[model samples]
Target: MTAFIENDVHAVAPEVAISFFKGIMPFDTLDEETLRSLARHCRIDFFPKGTRLLTADVTELTHLYFIQRGGVKAFLEDENGEVTLKDFRGEGAYIGALAIIRGTPANLNIETVEDTFCFLLPRDIFLGLIEKQASFAHFYLKSFSEKIVTTAYNELRHHKVTRRSNEDLYLFSIRVGDLVKTLRKVAASATIQEAAALMSEHRVGCLLIHDAVDAEKIVGIITDRDLRGKVVAAGLDFQQPVQTIMSTPVQTVLSQSLCFDVLLKMMDTGIHHLAVERAGKIIGVITSHDIMLLQGHSPYYLFKEIRGQQQISGLYPLANKIPDVIRGLIGEGAKAGNITQMIAILNDHILERMLTLLEQELGAPPVPYCWLLLGSEGRREQTFKTDQDNAIIYSDPEDETQAQAAAAYFKAFAAKAIDHLVNCGYPLCPGEVMAVNPLWCQPLSSWKRYFERWVSEPDPQELRYATIFFDFRAGFGEAALAESLRTHLNQHIKGRDLFLFHLARQSMETRAPLSFFKNFIVERDGEHKNRLDIKKQGLTPFVNFARVLALKFGVNETNTLARLKALRDGDWIQAELWSSASEAYELQMQQRLVHQLRQIEAETIPDNYIDPADLSDLERRMLKDAFTVIERLYGVLDQMYPVT
Candidate 1:
């Protein structure tokens, strides 16, 4: 079906020439002769600011816009006249190909963001070019991906702030010394009257009360709220020592610690102020106000909002807002691990609450049982809501007859909890790996038996089913049950060369889809033909790689990054290897998340498969870099533990 233009389309005028589209994408993929033939039909057009570039209802979208200068924004107007900005194109970009190729009226209106200049190629010519170049054809077919990058770029523009570096944006990178405005120090023995006077004089929210014995040591803190709640409200004597009203055992953070993690400490403990310590002495203080002003809608706000929920039904709306929060954070350049960790934390609260509510309805568990989160959720690396991989472990019953009754109660509780979770947006596990499955809802001793059997006799077919169990961690309930199992499993597997080798061999079975020629190895056929499965091919390689190393080192950390860090700290892995592998894993996760969000926004089922051609040049290179790192790591693993 090769399309050979009948002949070069002669320029309608001097301004319409083949030379116009020389370096533009898609056009760049064209050979000189073909490129010239198509460019002959291209005409340069100017669009003034506020001018309509394209109308949504136009019966014929005759032009394919390739921007040469300035900018244009595409928007979709829905019912009730609400308009959502869809995409933006600047110089070296193109638009209108999707609508023109599909032969459907585009549900978008393009308007000039500024006075813009573009090379317009007629719709008929563009289709002819698509048939001529496979690369050019692919670029247009991945409209969703192209839309995602443009939308993300627009989001970044909308939220861009001046006078802030990447370090300033990340709470974890902000040092306590960098955030403090002033240090107000006071003696612990200072009278409440004197403290009130100093507070009034300084107009500060809190005072760093030093220890009576060691002047350099900050023993407690007193805030305006403390004075109001403890003295003014409770009717305590105002003349008494400030220590009486001051909060003892004050929360503190190292001066060099990340402000974001420290903020989490304050939020977790309901502390308004935290003393900043440098070396061994008090340096300054950081208040909730400081973080609030610096970080808008911090994780603390989300944490409080999640925990404040009193009913399961109320969580739906709040949960819906989470995607916006994630998208905003990603736009602002937050790390993928940190973003996913925050999500996993918030999700834990929702699931734990659901379980608590179910307990109230179904009556308390017949025995102490731990609700274990497995797979990505267990690893705290869940970027998208896929399906719940969970199981329950209960105390072993004394009598064999009692086991049946206890299992039934737990199975019922698990079913109710899973049903509620599904309502809250977590889909049911397609593999039937959830706790409601009786095979997974087992007594602690039974779980031990399951692990021992898998380790002792490693069957590849059986290993696939039982392997993810190693990543399990207690999400709620009696954590001791999960803890005991982890200890038992680790002790059994440690130094078992055969078991570790088998695990490594099994993990090595999946390889990152990076080819020697530096092109992605995509699906050859089926529904996702020619698409890259970033999860199974990209993410799973690192997940499996890290799990093997963790088992080798007896590391209990479930997170891929955490496991790598533990290995690095133990001097078991080279620093360079750790950095590259970590970066590669993060890049893959971020790519998957970005792609999944696009699917969700489009109201389609979110998936890991992505069309590489849709990615901008920069993104495609970065993807290759990430895959290259994974390939290198696999080479090292193969050398160390060769398969028979």
Candidate 2:
């Protein structure tokens, strides 16, 4: 129905405006005096259903409309006049904040979905509030994203499980610099006795060895373990140069790196101590002891146990305990990203150990190669229910004899690796995408040809392969091979606009599990009756959307969050849209993890289906909101290349 604002109306009372503002956020954060000032300037208007309150054609937004009653639909309209719905916002939601704050036309349309009563704050008042109120300004800028993330984990805050010593906060929020106490260094020419004396004097666990010529340049490092195992135990002369005993190539992390990531690095590299660097210079050192002190029951112990295990049978029990550790982290309020990264770290350790054992049994390969992880594993976003999605990429062989030998060795290696991983609880990829498939285990040249064919000759089958293989990352072995393959893949897809268009269209094939009225559209019948495939329907859209844009723009990041961040920083996408997509992805991931965790706790095999009936009211709202964010992202893609 065509609509208009009521021409006849009484002026909105200040008390009424103040009352409404106090009930919502940002405004509720304001002081009473500031609220009164806003109330004094506010005016009310009633618009009939289908009223075009704002649109892309407007030169500038005149007022910020706060929905006092009823709701509105915001959407984008492309040059072809095809509309893509962005969201259904109800009471407490505001419109024109983006346009007014930027002094630009509305980037999308906001129209009344029902008979809507709105409290209108003029552009001048809104700008004045923004300039004078820091909290109010931050809300429009980024606080909404915080609310989105924090609200999603509200259930975690109230979980009845036994609480640990705030380990989640320490792991995710504390930086490496926070734990590093001091930097202790010695010249490479210093005697082992002098290094030991320095360690004793400072009461330190390790000492960084600097270059003999350049005092500022660190050349190596020696820890207490090295002093005991290499010097004391081996009966080396105490007067020998420390360089003879020092372990070359010290591990270092930036001062700002998270404790969680530091722990992962320590566990993965089997290092007890790491130098902490700021800019390019080492400032201090952090030990695994320091991290473990923050969380005495952390995964460091489990990782140590995994590293010490000699056989695959020993890893099975350890692998099963991982879900419990992750659940405990979640119960303590760790974010989805941190949880997944921790899972990936542990999984990587198991894979590394399994490969090492297998190599010992089968002998070394004929050529240098990398075990490439694809899809979620590649992105380091593994959850409890992950399967093997891997491939093998080896160097080009010297000759036919060499080629045959290389193929036979890796063929056996892949089969053993896959079997060992399955024994350790990682299921086989249903599609045979794992390295065990001879089709996927290939030399560098073959892998390059595969990517070129997939990107250049776009088709349903080819794009399917593109979607999976494009997210490859080297999990183990020679990383250079994987890096070279990534370079080749990115170069091939560059400037391939048609391929991107087809990819984007294919990405949208699995529609969000949302309906026209913003209700969840679940399965009609079968085992998943009344449930939705959260992984395929809720999660994959975000992954695919980011992949298409990242591919088009040559973003080399494999992780969804990182790709979205690159897109946002480059202004390839709107900052607000980036926040929405990121928060949405995290929330859905949290849902998926909690669901899988419950299944594991019940001793049942975990899957992706989520019943709307199982979610709390807030969770349901968050899920619906996430689905809306996915559609908005799709709208952006549609604007780029309309899927006709």
Candidate 3:
């Protein structure tokens, strides 16, 4: 009886190990018996720090190792004694899975960074285990498929970044040099009056001072603040030597450091100015104000400055510069989505500036009001040339005269602002769905009544209007005002199955770009003839699909991509399908950016069309793959909301 009990205990140990493996591995098909057999043959090994598991010369070896704990760094050492790290791997991941499965020599050296425990299964044992168990084989196949997908995605991203042709490197160098203050030097013996006049004439804040006796030595610095505080405040003569008042032991930055790094250091040290020095000589000076301005002044910054501006016309110059700022961000390789969000935020600032000016011109609102951004602007996804789609919502005043006065005031302000925005490059909405429209500019109660009408009666025209307006995001004014509107909509629409079905049907109006031959179908007419309508065909389907799902589920997030992700997380959509849809959207956006960049290089305006003849074979193939994803998503939409 004692011997039998011991045998049972030993037999169960592999089952326990298999359970642990099953939890982390991506195989849903693996059964208990198959896992037990695989686990019994897997040998657990412990290695101390510096233990190398594989080397570059080890070819034709087929074995897989799973790290249970500790870390490993895979790297390649060159003949020049330089080492480049390939990747870092930690707990629950298999190393050599790719190479082992492919029967190739290790492309990288893997060594333990610390004492590590890992399960090692030889190729023959792994194959034998899989052959005996159908479930185990299925899991292995799925794992391999996932790895291939991941590798493809990574390669795509790498190609996208590398194709920019060193533009990022050149821009980074210039920005860093400017931030580090590399320029010409001045003398310490210069008079305060001379320094102040030079600063004013050059429109510079600080001047670097070098020693007269030793030209290689940097002695001090003088800034506009030094003139105001040290010279003027002290009631000293303007003719006094700048060296008497200039800051000594000048703060310096190395020429090689990154601009962002220097900015952080300056912020940390609370210094307004930093001098760039090379071999003990002052090269140039960078002031806090210069950094702030070059960093791209925010809407808040503009608002603060515009508030003190005596003339309303002063806001125009700043508003005009918004497009240039956006171009600068794009040149710096800022993500498109992030750039759009920043633009939207800054647009709000511009709106606030206009509102402040208007308040002075027209007085405060007779009732509390909110200015709502609609359509893509409301979604905070405006690019450089997005049009105005906005409305006004205000609390209903008890007095009819007071309410009419408030509406008139807001409408006038909005009309003026819209005209300015058009001058600033944002065209007016073609449909005139703007706050200046009396129907759009309404009290909160009227807005609710309009939405209720749209929700209760599911007509085609009304559904189209609701689709645009439902993506409303607060641009300027009391956010609670927009929230109140959202709350009312949510309450009325939740469990209103008819409204959702209509929305779903309307969303299906735009089909995916896939042709019968699994190729992208190009536009037949209009300005984009023979070219793909990327925005209309590739992006809108996903965006519309996400929007309808979000509305049905009552997910309030406005960004299209965020809405899709939220729906997936809530299990309203499958994870794999949503992931594929997101990848397709990203690829489409990336192609658009590349086209836009080319147009910029050619000094022409960019558009959303991409001619198939213009793309490389690889890009053409990738675009097809992306279209396939879109088609799959459309299938999901059709299944969920079939058109009668």
Instruction: Report lDDT per candidate.
Output: 0.76, 0.85, 0.70
**Candidate 2 C-alpha lDDT tens digits along 290-319:** 887776457887888889999877888888
Clashes of 3: 0
Per-residue lDDT of candidate 1, residues 96-198 (tens digit)? 7767877876546878888777777788888887887788776665554445444444433332211224323457557777887678978989899889899
Better of 1 and 3 by TM-score: 1
TM-score of each: 0.68, 0.75, 0.60
**Which ten-residue region of model 3 has the weakest summed lDDT?**
1-10
* Candidate 3 residue-wise lDDT, 1-644, digit = tens: 01111111122257556766876754335677666677777666677778777776574455677887898887666566566335678988777755765567775678888877777767887666566767666666557545434433333334333333422322223444445543545677778788788777777777777786776677888777888888778899998777888788888886565554455455445576877655554557665555555545322244345446655567667665655545444555444554565566666666766777777887777888888999988777776566789998988888979877886788787788778667656778899999889899998999999999999998998898887899998877888999999999988998777877888777777776777877768888988889987777777777788888888889999888788889989999988787777766766666676566556556677678889887644467667877777667667767877767
User: Ten-residue segment with the worst summed lDDT in candidate 1?
Assistant: 1-10
The better candidate by lDDT, 1 or 2, is: 2
Question: Candidate 1, overall lDDT?
Answer: 0.76
How does model 1 score by TM-score? Answer: 0.68
Identify the candidate with maximal lDDT.
Answer: 2
Order of models, best TM-score first: 2, 1, 3
Give me the displacement of residue 297 in model 2, in angstroms. Answer: 3.5
lDDT of predicted model 3: 0.70
